[model samples]
Target: AQRVTQPEKLLSVFKGAPVELKCNYSYSGSPELFWYVQYSRQRLQLLLRHISRESIKGFTADLNKGETSFHLKKPFAQEEDSAMYYCALSASSGSARQLTFGSGTQLTVLP
Candidate 1:
């Protein structure tokens, strides 16, 4: 079974402060990891993918295969960055692709 874990349910940070959201996963085989974010009233959108090796909105996440972790980080936090973040894992289940998501982490950026 594949599982995604986000240890924190809520994280508060001041504007311009650095922020990191923790995430871990458990899967037998190689897994595809992704970070998804949902703004106040917007639809959920892809933040970053481990395979992409790119950064978006100053946020970056590296997949640590040995540690089975994919923690999201941002050097500087912005109030606009506040949102509901989710860690997800995609793996093959039989003949179909299965995605397992963490409970979610609500980030609040205070000015």
Candidate 2:
């Protein structure tokens, strides 16, 4: 089963606290991993991709093929970063954009 799992349903902390959004996956074929985030009433947007290796909004994700995991992390989570975070994986067969998503984790940053 190709699946993405986010263990934490919700995480809340102070504005300067570190944040980590765990993600795990199971897939038979080669997979591309990505993280998507939704802030307040905004649309879900791509936070980062394992392939990109770029950090967005102080967030970075590393893909571990052996462990089948891609976790999002930031040294200090910000209030604006508070949002719904989803771990996703996609295949080459369908649209590159067609991703299977996890339920998601809601991150709250308090002042």
Candidate 3:
């Protein structure tokens, strides 16, 4: 079974501090990994992907294939960056499956 586990349900802290949103996954095949973020009431946006090795919204995610994890990290979080983050993966197919989202970690950035 493919599963994504985000241990933290909520993370609250002040602005301009480092933040790490942990994520671990289990899958038999090589699946595509991604970090999805939802701010306020907006749609979920892709933060980063394992294949891309890119950072978005001041965040970066590293895929540790051996560890079966893709943890999201940010050197310094901003007030505007406060949002719900989810770790997701999809197995591509003739008809690609929907991105499975984790429970979500509510990241709150104080003023």
Candidate 4:
């Protein structure tokens, strides 16, 4: 079984401060990992992927295979960056793609 874990349910950060949202995963084989974010009143969208190696909206997450972690980070938090973030894992299971999501983390950037 594949599982994703987000340790914190909610994280509050001051504007201009650095932020990190913890995420961990367990899987038997190679897995595709992604971060999805939802802003207030906006639909959920893909933030970044472990394979993409791109930064979106000043947020980046590096997949650590050794620790089985993909923690999202931003150098400076902004009020506009406040949103709910989810860590998801996808892998082929018995000729079908299976996606497992972690409990989302709600980030609140206070100005």
Greater-lDDT candidate between 3 and 4: 4
Candidate 1 residues 18-94, lDDT tens each?
A: 99999999999988898999999999998988888899999999999999999999999999999999999999623
For candidate 4, the lDDT comes to 0.92
Alpha-carbon RMSD to native, per candidate: 2.2, 1.6, 1.7, 2.2
* Candidate 3 per-residue C-alpha lDDT over 45-69 given as tens digits, one digit per residue, 9 for 90 to 100: 8788888788777789888989989
lDDT of 4 by residue, 1-111 (tens): 889999999999999999999999999898888899999999988899888889999999999999999999999999999899999998863344657999999999999
Could you tell me how far off, in angstroms, the CA of residue 110 lies in candidate 3 after the best superposition? 1.3
- Give the residue spans of candidate 1 off by over 4 A: 93-96
Residue ranges of candidate 4 with Cα displaced over 4 Å: 93-96
Q: How many residue pairs clash in each candidate?
A: 0, 0, 0, 0
- The TM-score values for the models, in the order shown, are 0.94, 0.93, 0.91, 0.94
Tell me the lDDT of candidate 1.
0.94
Q: Indicate which candidate wins on TM-score.
A: 1
TM-score between candidate 3 and the true structure: 0.91
Candidate 2 Cα outliers beyond 4 Å, as residue runs: 93-97
Residue pairs in clash, model 1: none
Question: Model 3's lDDT to the true fold?
Answer: 0.87
Give the per-residue Cα lDDT of candidate 2 at 78: 83
